[model samples]
Target: MNHFLALTRRGAIALAFALTLPLPAVAATKIQHLISPGGIEAWFVQDSTVPLIAMEYAFGGGATQDPPDKPGVGNMVASTIDEGSGDLDSKAFHERLDRRAIELSFSITRDYFRGSLRMLKDNKDEAFDLLHMALTSSHLASSDVERIRSQIMSGLRRDTTNPNALASRKFLELEFANHAYSRPASGTLESVPTITVADMRDYISRVIAKDTLKIAVVGDVDPATLGQLLDKTFGSLPAKAKLTPTPDVVATAPPQRAFVPLDVPQTTITFGAPGVMRHDPKFMAAYIDNHILGGGGLSSRLYHEVREKRGLAYSMFEALLWMDHSSLVVGNTGTRADRAGESIDAIDKEVRKFAQEGPTQQELDEAKSYLKGSQMLQLDTSSKLATAMLQYQLDKLPIDYLERRSGIIDAVTLDDARQMAKRLWGQGLVTVVVGREPQAAAEAARAPGAPPPPKAN
Candidate 1:
């Protein structure tokens, strides 16, 4: 028997082209809702291929809720949640987690507190039960409280001497003066020492209201099962949704350049000011615009002009930090003691130019490409997708926010980016520089006998 095969060049080329075609769409994990009979709302996605399940729970109450005296209380409480919960002491809790191979952690930000858990789908029941207890029935043990408190206070004490840390703290205070956002998320030394257990409990109850609780789960669970799980976990918590009120944004003064003399060899410089909040319509436009200005890594104007071309600093750029009603655009860089001013001047020049003329067509195209590529990459894992979805939910964004996102960038022409830049750039940018030996240099200019130069602006 003989077998023969033959194909013309046209046929072979067609076959190759067919092989190169993209694969069929993997149905994007659809976001579904499961409302507990007790009124808790949860958003979930089902993907059966992975053997893991991840869940995140967030409360509106965050560091901003801390009493003015105990600034870091919220942060401490967030960290202590899983350290001990219900009947399990911290040691016992760790043992249980190790036995089950469960991953659980919590964190607090200026605006919200987050509890996250990841476990094998087969072990999800036990992992979730432990997590639920941690959230609703944390022991708030005195020992753990003091333990975390000590760590935070120690860090705060150290912050005063760390130029980078001091700069950030001072900048927040200056930019958000009179606004809770101005306060550091980690409470000050005074506040941390005074924060009591009662304060922690009250803060959690008030800030972690049902409405404030946004749940995001991604894994092999079905909608019905997820609903049951949510009910079992968070159902008994208070149904009342008492969210943290939005903080006010005071009119901050314009760019004030100040330098703090540190004992360090290098200088850290930071610039920019009040910026657009999460829900602003200009949010997307500003995001793309900043990408071109500095947020786009090596492709950004600040990086291209400041570091690559002029060799002024190793890193430079602007980033948006947003909370409930308060937000800011902060640019930062570190350079030689003498060259720090040069970096700041270069960054300021680029910022002003972008504010006035806007991004060129080429810049806009590059930003769009970089942003779209990032958007696609950020969804690489179920957990990341879930987290992203939860953020949109918390911000009251539409479920299709992801699908509509690329269009926002594409619709942003060069002029739109420029307009955003102009409106958001702060003329009263507070510049903070930390360095050693500059104390005597012409640039130092410290008032005689002042305690110490403040951190970078």
Candidate 2:
């Protein structure tokens, strides 16, 4: 039997067992705060149900740390870091991983450079050693860098015609104008080519350090053993990161509609307005309010109005997006090119009404109940739990946040939810629609005395 398959089977069995536990038992998961001898720290959840370990970690200064002209450096580093490290060439490094059934990967969001590792507990020593090498001694060789660059460039080319990508990119460009947040994390076609091996190495040195690190581990490991592994894996990094100070910014775009013309049959729409930050006292209220509005899936008001009532689109959604430095209530949907304007109108009307009237007492109660119960879905697996714990750490939430989460949601009264709705959505949305010009605009242009249609960008 394949070791990898065996491990996966055992993991599934463990997950099934975990799912059978009461929600309170899962929520009361004991989180041990551990500090290694070398001063490295991690949040650990000891689960001996399966002989596997999953680690998730992040460092501050993600794509925002890239040079303005070479915006993809952080992304490139993330893609190439695990290709080779220490004395191992690319092939040798991967072969070692394959032999041990270890899984290691890296990614970059606008605010964080993240990594994850999963392996059998029996191979913990080698797994941690490989992780340390990838962090401290990644060999971003010329050949590997060029190959990855080509891949990124190809993807960028494809994104040009992808309506969803176009709408999202244009929305960010318009909303965050002149701010670092506007730049694409994957680097643009022009920027990716300009990135060099030196840039990748420099980014790793400046951004990956103990000072900005947050880690979460879930597995069959004790605090003492985890403490030692933490030091051994991360202690060699620099004490502090040399991240450039990124300024706080809100959505600067005017509350108006922008259009990107593509030949796609279905128009993709992206819209947003300023929102509350993560640590704000009102965030929990905003969370419940958004759930009632659009974040609650099929039960949401947006879905019912846009899809069920109007039949304008198959689905629609909105959520509160809180970045490290900025926040927004963002939403998206798709519709036939000819019906795009109507769909937008329907969505906007609902949003404006919600902002004015807020949720009813019944809506508020149901939203609170659904949000409270959904916490279990986030903790059903070790990897998922690790990822969620890491995010809580990033958000500066307390370790007991899981236990306290339900109470927080329950405390948001109808009055509080109503207030939060007005605060979050009252400002209106700046919308981006990517497809052919809406039929309404086209008809207006063709009317007897109408001005000529505006040329596409």
Best by lDDT: 2
Cα RMSD of all models vs. native, in order, equals: 11.8, 6.4
TM-score of each: 0.87, 0.91
- What's model 2's overall lDDT? 0.83
Clashes of 2: 0
Error of 1 at 94 (Å): 1.3
TM-score of candidate 1 versus the correct structure, residues matched by position: 0.87
lDDT of 1 at 322: 66
Q: Taking the tens digit of each residue's C-alpha lDDT, what string does model 2 give over 1-457?
A: 0000112111233334543443333335888788888888888888877677888999999889999888899999988998899999889988888777777788888889988888878889898999999999888999999988998899999999998899889988887887888999899998999898888888998999999999999887888888889999998899999999999998764477898988766789998888788999978999888888988888999999998888888558887877888877778898766678888999899999999999999999998888888888758778778888888898999998888899998888888988988887887889999988666545654679855543211
Task: Score residue 212 of candidate 1 by CA lDDT.
Answer: 72
Task: Give all candidates' CA lDDT scores.
Answer: 0.72, 0.83
Measured with C-alpha atoms, the lDDT of residue 306 in candidate 2 is 90
